[model samples]
Target: MATADPYGPVHTEGNAVPPLDPDLAGALDDLAGIHPGIDLIRDGIRHLALDRHTPDTTQTLLATLAGSSGADAITAIGHLIARLANADHNPALRGLPLDTQKQAQRHGEQAAFHLNDPTLHQPASEASAAITGT
Candidate 1:
């Protein structure tokens, strides 16, 4: 069973508040598996990356997507971050520290956090065994 936050819906702390319409939530969630050819993850809290989003913002986005279907919310969230990290102009996402980048590369379904930056990155799940010491 998934645990819901007492906050229920309206978000404020991280990024600007997200739209709370159930229909919008459902649509965004459906995008999870569509393979957004362009990655959506980024390091900052605005512009075209996921990093531009706050943890609460990300959570809100994921929760909305999770409500849509059988998709795994975690992975959906990860994909969004991956999209952002791979973006071309996100300063916060420029070359990352080797160790930190490695861990982000390891998240099979979840996001990897930059300990120093607190920004989320897409896990390098499939590219390298170096991440797993394999």
Candidate 2:
């Protein structure tokens, strides 16, 4: 099992940090494609946290979650939720029509619900156990 890349390679010299497992990396890529704003929001939060010089609970929690397989999906979903909510309040998003804003809000709510869904957080072994009643 590989680890998460906390410090993404700047020089691009074959990635200085350890890479995430192939499956997790692929899943993260797929999620980013589905929610285009997820990466933007994640990067923004990370930058802001670093700039503030204060404890970043969100970053810390996500890093901890990334330690395990499948947890990155939950973290990505959470970032999508945050992105939607942030866009809804941002002045730039105001330029969008009312219907578009409503759509974004709806997407955010849906993501939030998905984030709260218990099954999303369950490990495969745990899920299998529940299914088999073992």
Candidate 3:
């Protein structure tokens, strides 16, 4: 079976990372279309100011998730949390400065409120009660 590259290219030619598989790139592009925060993740990576070349880190994240084992909804929620909530800690965005991390988190938190649905996320009080089984 042809497994996807769990991680993208091992080496790059002077910051020129290899092109992603067309299908994978397409899928990532589709995600960007629907999820505005996905691009925020992309922009956050670009803003990292690293000397080395960076590939599409958001796409890299999704591609990596493609190889992991998990329920679809769980994986997706986790992906959002990583990209939006814990942007700095995620593999692609790890080691970023504190301000940047906070910025990403703020955007994420705002997204949660703006996109909130009772069915999707319970109120904070209810969540706390559920967790403590109170």
Winner by lDDT? 2
Error of 1 at 86 (Å): 5.7
lDDT for each residue of candidate 3 in 1-134, tens digit (9 for 90 to 100)? 98878887656675454455677556556667556777875444434323233334433333333322242233455556546566555655457887887777777766544444333323433433444455
| TM-score for each candidate, following the candidate numbering | 0.23, 0.39, 0.27
Tell me the lDDT of model 3 at 70: 45
Per-candidate total of colliding backbone pairs: 15, 0, 0
Candidate 3 residue spans exceeding 4 A from truth: 1-29, 32-83, 119-134
**lDDT of candidate 1 vs native?**
0.42
lDDT of 1 at 130: 32
Candidate 2 residues 37-126, lDDT tens each?
767755554454344332344444443444223355565666656575655566667878888877887777777666645565555435
**C-alpha lDDT (0 to 100) for residue 67 of candidate 1:** 29
TM-score of 1: 0.23
The per-prediction CA RMSD against the true structure, in angstroms, equals 17.3, 12.4, 16.9
Stretches > 4 Å off in candidate 1: 1-64, 70-76, 85-91, 112-134
Better of 2 and 3 by TM-score: 2
Residue 21, model 3: lDDT of: 61
